[model samples]
Target: MQSSIIIADDHPLILKGLNDFLLEKKYNVLASAVNGKDALELIETHKPEIAILDIQMPYYTGLEIAEKCKALNYQTKIVLITFEKDEAIYKQAKSLGVYGYVLKEFALTEIEQCIDTVSKDIPYFSPELLSYLEVESTPKELETLTPTEKEVLKHIAQNKTAKEIGDLMFISNRTVEKHKSHIIKKLNLAPIQNSLLIWAKENQTLLE
Candidate 1:
């Protein structure tokens, strides 16, 4: 049986493009909407097998609608399309159990696969999205370090000894050791011998 699909996007061009593409591929596109409210209404009325929604829409965002569907125990699987590469948004989508997440840039190229994967009761995410998240996540985790800790990490990345780092930074060796301990804790290192050093070396490029 052909899966029933409902698509929603605020931009007319995107909505039409996606709808037309699905139609061209011989998929059953049940309905299309221009806003989140209308989209939600269609879902309630039609209860499609899959819903492809733009993340940002009037009245309610895609994430919100997905949450509502989950709350109401709908059988519809949601696939969110967005331009956002934000960590928080992606995390929220995963938490809501959204079936698919496709970036706007890759929507046309990836949507077919996304729908296919979701119809099989599997989750799909843009490959670029995962790479972007990995790159963005490092900077955020690095942000948790204090300025002093960052500098200590940089020195460690350079293979500086505690005494050498202390001399260069004009702090006492004891103080440098204290900073290293704090850095290890902040970075969640295993506290095994040379674990901090290994992490520092592996992430040296990011440290710079």
Candidate 2:
């Protein structure tokens, strides 16, 4: 049986393109909305098997809509469409019980796979994000962290700059930087790509 799905996006091209693409993929495209309000309404009304919502939408963001659905105990699976691959966003999506996290650029390449996975009540994240789960996300790597490094990691996840962390920790900015470097080394994250921050954002719940 074809999967019944609803999609929403502010961009006209994206809304139509996704509609056509899902139809071509043999999904039952129940409705497509150009704005967020309609998206939520359609989902509430139709209760399709899945709802694919763009992250940045007018009135209510996709995340907000997902939250509402969770509160209402709606059974429709949610797929968050986003250009941002931030780990913090992923964390929030996970908390919201989001089923799929597909980057806009990879929609054509990954959406079908994402929906297929979510259709079975499994969660799916963007392709590029899979590496983080293995890199610094291993339980052994996390276990190697000391108390001070863990504090710094929490600050990084909270979006605090090094200077801010230094002020809070009563340390010099240079010392903070050293600690950050150590944290990255221990986590096996890259030094240049802000990978530490990414890991922090994506794994906030773990730190808590």
Candidate 3:
């Protein structure tokens, strides 16, 4: 059976284009809304199988609407369209049970795949977004290291021995080892042999 869908976006061109595309794909598009208010009303009234919402809509953003729908126990599956590649928004979407997250730039190319996946009771996120998140996560984890720990890590990345690092930093070997232990703990690396050295080598470019 054709999936019942409602799409909304503040941009007229995007809204029309998406509606037409879904129609061409033979899906039953019940309504289109220019704002989140109308979108939520359409969703509440039509109870579509999927609601494709723009994340930055007026009155209520997509995440806000998703939260409302969840509170109301609505069964409509949400597919959020956005230009944002932000981690906080993505995490909020996941928390609100959004079924699909498509980047606005890739909306036309990716929407069908998102719908297909969501229809099968699976969540879908843009592959590009996932890659961005993975890259972002590494920097965040690296941020946990103190300045001295990071300096120690950078030296380790250059294949520096503990004594060499201690000499370069004007610290003792014991202090260098202590910093190494702290770095490993902050990075949550295993206490196995050379794990800290291996991690530093692998992420050398990030250190620079």
Model 1, residue pairs in steric clash: none
| lDDT of each residue in 183-205, candidate 1, tens digit only | 88877655568978977876777
- TM-score for each of the candidates: 0.66, 0.65, 0.67
Give residue 12's lDDT in candidate 1 (0 to 100): 98
Q: How do the candidates rank by lDDT, highest first?
A: 3, 1, 2
Reference-based lDDT, residue 25, model 2: 74
lDDT (0 to 1) per candidate: 0.90, 0.86, 0.90
Ranking by TM-score: 3, 1, 2
lDDT of 3 by residue, 1-208 (tens): 8789999999999999999998998988999999999999999899999999999989998899999999999999999999999999998998899999999899989999999878877788897897677676664568998889999999999999999999999999999999999888888665668979877876777888
Q: Write the per-residue lDDT of candidate 2 for residues 8-87, one digit (tens) a residue.
A: 99999988998998888788999989888999999989999999999999999999999999999999999999888677
Residue 154 lDDT (model 2): 96
